[model samples]
Target chain A: MDKQEEQFVKAYAPATVANVCCGFDVLGFALDAPGDEVWARKKETPGILISAVTGVEGLSADPTLNVIGVVAQKMLTDLNLEHGLELQLHKGMPVGSGLGSSAASSAAAAFAVNALLGNPFTTQELVVYAMEGERLASGSAHADNVAPSLLGGFVLVRGYDPLDVIPLGVPLDLYASVLYPQIELKTSLSRSILKQEIPLKKGIKQWGNLAGLMAGLLMKDYGLIRRSLHDEIFEPERSVLIPLFKQVKDAALKAGALGCGISGSGPSIFALSPSAEVAHDIKNAMEKVYAGSGIETKSYVSKVPEQGVRLVEQSIYQTV
Target chain B: MDKQEEQFVKAYAPATVANVCCGFDVLGFALDAPGDEVWARKKETPGILISAVTGVEGLSADPTLNVIGVVAQKMLTDLNLEHGLELQLHKGMPVGSGLGSSAASSAAAAFAVNALLGNPFTTQELVVYAMEGERLASGSAHADNVAPSLLGGFVLVRGYDPLDVIPLGVPLDLYASVLYPQIELKTSLSRSILKQEIPLKKGIKQWGNLAGLMAGLLMKDYGLIRRSLHDEIFEPERSVLIPLFKQVKDAALKAGALGCGISGSGPSIFALSPSAEVAHDIKNAMEKVYAGSGIETKSYVSKVPEQGVRLVEQSIYQTV
Candidate 1:
């Protein structure tokens, strides 16, 4: 461990949505605004250490299950860099709320560690590392959330072979209203319930929408994105688990959201709008829907944070 | 019908493949070196009239069953064009051979009539008209083949709402080897045999390929297009109808073809190559594969024709 260093590091990892309804395990983008923050300090020690943790409750009996712990260890191992670290993870977002809580933690850890190592990895490379941590939490190495969390904008995974990621333009006038109902749907269980096979016709529709969605992102055409946001395969079954899913979605649309749909594997829903004015109305509508169903919900009205994970503050200490 | 006219005006139609394998229906291009030619001339009569027919045998059974005849009538009705004319269609490409014979016929007739009427419509407008003709043949409205036929070049249907069609850069060095076995697979029947459902995992794979394919076309990257021309949904099931399908595909790959697969439907296959040398080798390999299987076949080696359908040559009809 480098005992002489004394700089505190803080970072942010934004929210993301996977699948986009029709493009399950394939398509995703960074939500405009709202993210988790993490701060850490380097310490002198003989062995790797996560001396502290917060904003995390009942995470896992095994340290390996903790996203930050796992990601921190992997980054160290991948770089062959040894360091004892005192970590403070601000779990600013709810756990398992389908807003990429796990991804946020992994991203925050990756960002801090990359900075600690002198930022040796590129943003996409960090995403690849973060996805490894996410896989420990969800049992799949999906980059949809991690890519956006690290890149801080609309990220497209063109193909995996030599992974091509496209960062697209976004309309500045819009803010997304994201809501999390009290209803809980475990990410692992939600994914397990899905059918292994889907209709060929459904696949066709999904591709068309996905293509249109990519185009919409590139052009920053809000209407095109909204009209193209369809989830023909995964949402039908997953939505049943979220109480009043249709009510919330319909209400969001009525409230002037360009479009609305479940975020990740929900209990959470997100609505797209041109401004906070529209986002505020959508939020109220969503709250009303949740209220009608006798469920408490939490919501955030914000824009997509274009700056991905970064070091906010850092410090170092030595014990000889 | 044109008793007072010196020469009888006639029209022809071409065959087309709508989906074009990987793209389903949204994307398609034209095959121009060979196509059906439609002829149209003024007549004393005030409506369309049919005269001598070539290539297509026994198409006179019903005017509705004849895709060309139906499209011509629809165009006339839609535009409310009132003129005396006779139509003649020369079927050059074999039907159900996966060479887009239907689209060729439809586009030929539409172009001839429009030319005879002084070109009132743009290329895109003609594509929509040709699609109506394809509907008569395949029971679906698709514009891929029609668009390329009317407007020659590779195209991207960015979206259908505004009907955006962006032309892509064509790779000059790319050549194709097409082999048609003396067998038939009706497009409708081919459409029917497909499984209606597709798995989400596979959907991701398809989109990856789609993106790669688009990038390859845009960048004029032959290697990329070859590596990405994977048709996950249609090729496997349809390839069964082509003799020695596996062997032919293997030989083509071994002989320097980047990638090879079933073209349009069955009984025909195509390979992508970077040069004429590789293309000719693929042709010889395909012949070897089919000859051993006791199937008579014809082959054509050509580049992506930069031009679609046009009036190749016309003998001027003097006023009687």
Candidate 2:
């Protein structure tokens, strides 16, 4: 556990679905699979070095251009640690697919570096560091994705001035089916398309749905959750960017999914179901809509995870 | 209980504080004191009649103009009952005080008439009828006030098209301290001054606070409740209409109140405290702000009530 120990620490961070329908910019939850992994090793040098990047193309090995390097540098600077680190990132999900690709990398890197340094911070304390990576990627530091990827479960980013990230209760029998249409949609472009001003009446309905969703989660009321998973503002405008969005949503609902909506600023669509079987069925139904449309698709059926980034492997005095 | 019985039934409905800061147009909670009462008697005649109206002036006794008569008529027509009714309204609170005065009257009338007709409707089922009275009173059928007044406890109006009124849990020790300034701030005027559209950022914050407040209530987290009781949208525009608004809020917070803000529209201020002693202190502090300012104010310190409109007395075979 010594701070100076020469060791390699590897961690896994899950992909997260942000904005959970009606809870735009405030709510998110982590999925069990399709995550990223980061390996960190304490070095005698005084700066960060990216050893390798794997499982993805067109990514930078330069520390200044990658999310893993950005997150680790921030953590070390904030902790006043002069020790250098070598890091490796392996992307398990598609970048820019709106499944929080950058968030997973940032969370995994923050968690791995923290573990390599003998753990000076709690898991909750790592959120701010991860958000720095999001700022680098999306031009805005939002915690909806990062907090869930770092802390797991459903997280409500109640406020940003003080960064109040609350871990909310989730229903025991909930499952999520996410379908990522293989299309490039920039987060900035998706965000810019949104109306800066929304009708007050629509705002009221959105908040009501958010409250209902929160209550449903705490009480484990599936009917309330289903009723509350509606987005009146974001979906109307953003869904046009994705092909067959309406058709996919309709298929999911018909397959016994509790609710369906775009995930994040999405080319990705997510549906919630009561059980694993329904989630799988929903996934198949969602996929069949895009079959032979000349576009590829990736989908995942996962339970909302209870744990986020964690040290998956550790070896002391390992040579890099 | 028989529908044909010639009986006089009386009901009392507690005053409610709607909006509850960040939950504008969506949330409310009932109070233990300062309410309204209504008496209903089955009549042999074939038309609705208002026998008397007391405790407040400038009110009509006409069946169409009075809220009680309007609500009873709606209930009877909806239930397919040809029976006529005679009603008397007793106002226990000031008119247009922003303490849900009209809602209390509407709720009491609905409860009393339902009882006089042998309880044909459940208390929850009476919210729509009471909302009709609200529409007549404020030109809008908002249920934030009426739901809490009918269902008791903290209530969230999740949606309006379907009229989903969900009763939420209340902390066992929560207390509300309300101060109503005698100055008249019409609900219609206060509502009209609000901007029809709001910035998306502000909307996000408002919903975040609402979610936090809902989580706080369900989990009984006092600190969370205090932190979440903030209004970013309505209070900024509406607080200007109330005299000495900022000073009263400051005094309430300085006196150990958890949170404070304008109640309903304007001219009335409410503060929440953890204990009865602190609530009383907050009430005194709030009242002291208006002392000698030539603005008359009435204050009440009470626990968040568990019961709403209920039958107070039932006399069978009573003459109208």
Candidate 3:
């Protein structure tokens, strides 16, 4: 496709919290309407190439070293497709901030490149490609965030091969509030502070919450979600690193959030509420707690992202 | 009521395994048509007391120290039902040999006692009472095996407070093979070896499997269930004690079992198969491995206990 017909494939992928409280790396849902954007065009050249970056002042446009670049290249390499990508990342979400900002960029780029390459890979194969982005971030391959980002809604990664992804019918009433502090807690560091061997007792506690969370997502049972949101392993260890973790979480509960916890690896907190009314209230409470700590924060009161990364406009000369 | 007019309650409680590999103590399920038996009758003395033990050797009829006795007292105390009881516990299963020997006995006594007391608590509450019994043995409130034994079928313990229990709709094609290898991995000793904290990377993998298992149960999707039946956290650590763990698991997989793992703590292993045909194959393979290990093993091929603890003959009574 030439520049005249060169429509920009601008796709918006949500910022996901990979370890959603009880679920750790295997569970994640997309943020509704609040994600980052990646705009790509098929180049006449034959390899993936990052052309521009914005909002992330520290990032480089080098295609090989960038997280977004690596994901796009892996997808093309695996699919045996030969096409260069001119990717422009509009960093709407933060970097190394634990909202899965990098994954959003990666998902967007992989999704766009695949689209530009005529979309040969299946949705799950795209997820595998997106996981390369996660491997780059933390040196471990995880699908919790990437799977949901690629498939949309709530996805259970049953297995990698034959790729069993079960779609949970999300409750229509769910509203979420995610508060991001100005400080960044790199995924690498947040993960490092965690202990290597969890007590068997704590392991059971975490999975109990995991099973309940899965049920809650399927049944949209808010009460069960609140009861199941307890994370005995990561939160106890990682929360100590996040300022005012207790106060913010208590605020969320007091503000009527069904439950609240540090999102992913901290510096960001998330609350689950049954209504938009409660979601906003929970957001305000988190804001108040962060304010007391002399930290500015960005918060979102949204729903689970239903449509994952999608072309904002046909780029038939477009935007989303 | 005289002996001729006595109200006798008899109940069958299936064997259960707590922790269930990845789930630890928070997840468990009951095996059908094979377990233990409890027979209870109201005492004429107006106080709770145990009177007999028929099967498990070394078990006593004491009302305090006996596993079944303590659990029975707790159940009656909650009901404020002061009635001495004549309890006969028929231990069809082995003691201290995994397969939830202690849990089955406790659940049966509590369940029988509950029936004797007019059934005041819900099934979940009975599990709570049974968990109290486990505390006597392990010194903590754990529910891996007790929940499923009391509630029957597959159980996902979401939380302890208000105890979120989700009953999984198991696949109709599912058949379970419980192999007892004439050995015992004491819950206490097995538990003591676990690390105090787990690595962040591995924790997420466990949660992924947990969610996948739940989804598999709900969807009755066998392939998903097999793929999801993984224990990244506990099994890796605990399986070290169970000799031939990997080879046995591999053989079962090769024999067409959906998934196989260490049942309860150790010395026993269970495999899920699609049919009795596959189950027989699993039995042969498992027996071949453990039999060669210089360890004698027993196996039970069954299905999920469809109806949990229940009255077999409510109004009728027959004893030879």
Candidate 4:
């Protein structure tokens, strides 16, 4: 083994907001804070191992059961690297929070291991390996979350058959506010409630909004973004499951938010604003909706980050 | 009456290609040639009249039956102008060729009359008035054609309730080639064959492509535009109605066209290319498919113009 093999690399992957209102299953962006961290070390052995997991309870340490371990194993197998990997996952975000918790861990682990091996694959090339973790967690291999968590900025999952994930231009002044209710909403149950068939007229309107939102982001038109960030397909059906969804959305909009909608398959809600001050105000307004209602909530205000799955720390250690 | 009322104001409105593959009923762009012209004059009396109709047989000269007359009458009524108007309609493109023939007439009349009345409305304000002519012709008030024909460049009809028409950026090097097969396909028949409900999976894919195409246009990414110019919902059902649709599309792509699809309703195929030379090549290749098949065809190759309707000529004359 090389001298670099004895070093431990810790990487941080940002939490992502998938679906992004009008762009269901197609758009996502990374947040600046509240991300997962993974520490990776390569060994002379030939099997993947999860040394520990922290920051969240009830997570398994088994290499086959953990998301980070599974993603790292896939990367190693795909690259034909016979070296063993040891990982420690620190979850900074709650699971089932609609904040792409699993995607963050997978991206951090894959990025850390790639860094340890001198990055044989580009950051864009690591999206597929990270998607396997989403499939294990949500029973579907979707890149909306994984792509943004790995690539940062705004991402468009243009297609899935050939797996085309495109990184889009991000408006630098845009900010996001997320309010997560401390309740679990199963991704499968949320998905099952959606109608399999939609009216053609509604579908046309949805795509129009998608096109408008994409154009608004590219041109940095705030009014167009506010007008286009609406969901007519998935939000109506899924919002019934979220407590006080309408009230939260209304409060966010009243607090100077550009747009607001359910975050992923939610119990969580997200609102976008033009500035960090407005985003903080939106977060406060959203939190007020759940106040005195016996529901605990966690809120985050952040600027959309430009980088994802970055190496945070690295240290050399002596083997016992 | 004023001295300007005695002069003849002639305006030209360009033909448009609607649907634009993935963006059905929402996207369109203006072409440079094969447009209609309208000559308008205000008299001291208070009723609208169509003085002459030329360049196409079987068009009505009656104010109520002619599209230009109807559009001009509506505009006068809406603006509360109590002046008599005389219009001369000159059709430069074939009717029912899926080249937005009626939309051109409506836009030209609206634009000409607006100019004659001291330019009371902006170009964007004329789209709704132009869409009224579409309703009279096609039984549906769709602005996909008239919006682009009035606003120039590419337009997205984001919504219909309040009528939101947004103009998109067009690449300077983009060229379009259109081949209109001389066949009449009724708009109602073309619309009736479409299914009312579609699978949600197909809808997701369609929106993904729509977002990608909009991004491609705003960023001037030719490869992304080529990849995203696909129609999963409309073209499949509509292409079967057009003769040699598959053969023409295949030939265009093989001849270095970026994308090819049915224009407006049917019988007209449009291809976009990076340069005017490649667009001309695509036009030739598409024309060869129907050369010996006994189908008469009209082909046009032009760069996408930045201006739509404009005053082509003005002449002063005495009231006889």
Instruction: Kindly report, for each predicted structure in the order presented, the TM-score of its chain A compared with the true chain A.
Output: 0.90, 0.97, 0.92, 0.97
Ranking by lDDT: 2, 4, 3, 1
DockQ per candidate:
0.38, 0.88, 0.50, 0.85
DockQ, structure candidate 1: 0.38
Pairs that collide, model 4:
none
lDDT, candidate 4, A2-23, per-residue tens: 7656699999999999989999
Which should have the higher TM-score, number 1 or number 3? 3
What's the best-to-worst order under TM-score? 4, 2, 3, 1
Model 4 whole-model lDDT (C-alpha atoms): 0.90
Docking class of 3: medium
lDDT of 1 by residue, A3-110 (tens): 566666788777776655544665556764566776665566523455555666766523376777778777777776556666666777788888888898889888
Candidate lDDT values, in order: 0.71, 0.90, 0.76, 0.90
Best by lDDT: 2
**Per-residue error (Å), model 4, residue A91:** 0.2
lDDT of 2: 0.90
* lDDT for residue B284 in candidate 2, whole number 0-100: 94
What digit string (tens of lDDT, one per residue) describes model 2 on residues A53-72? 99999999998889999999
Model 1 chain A poorest 10 in a row by lDDT = A165-174
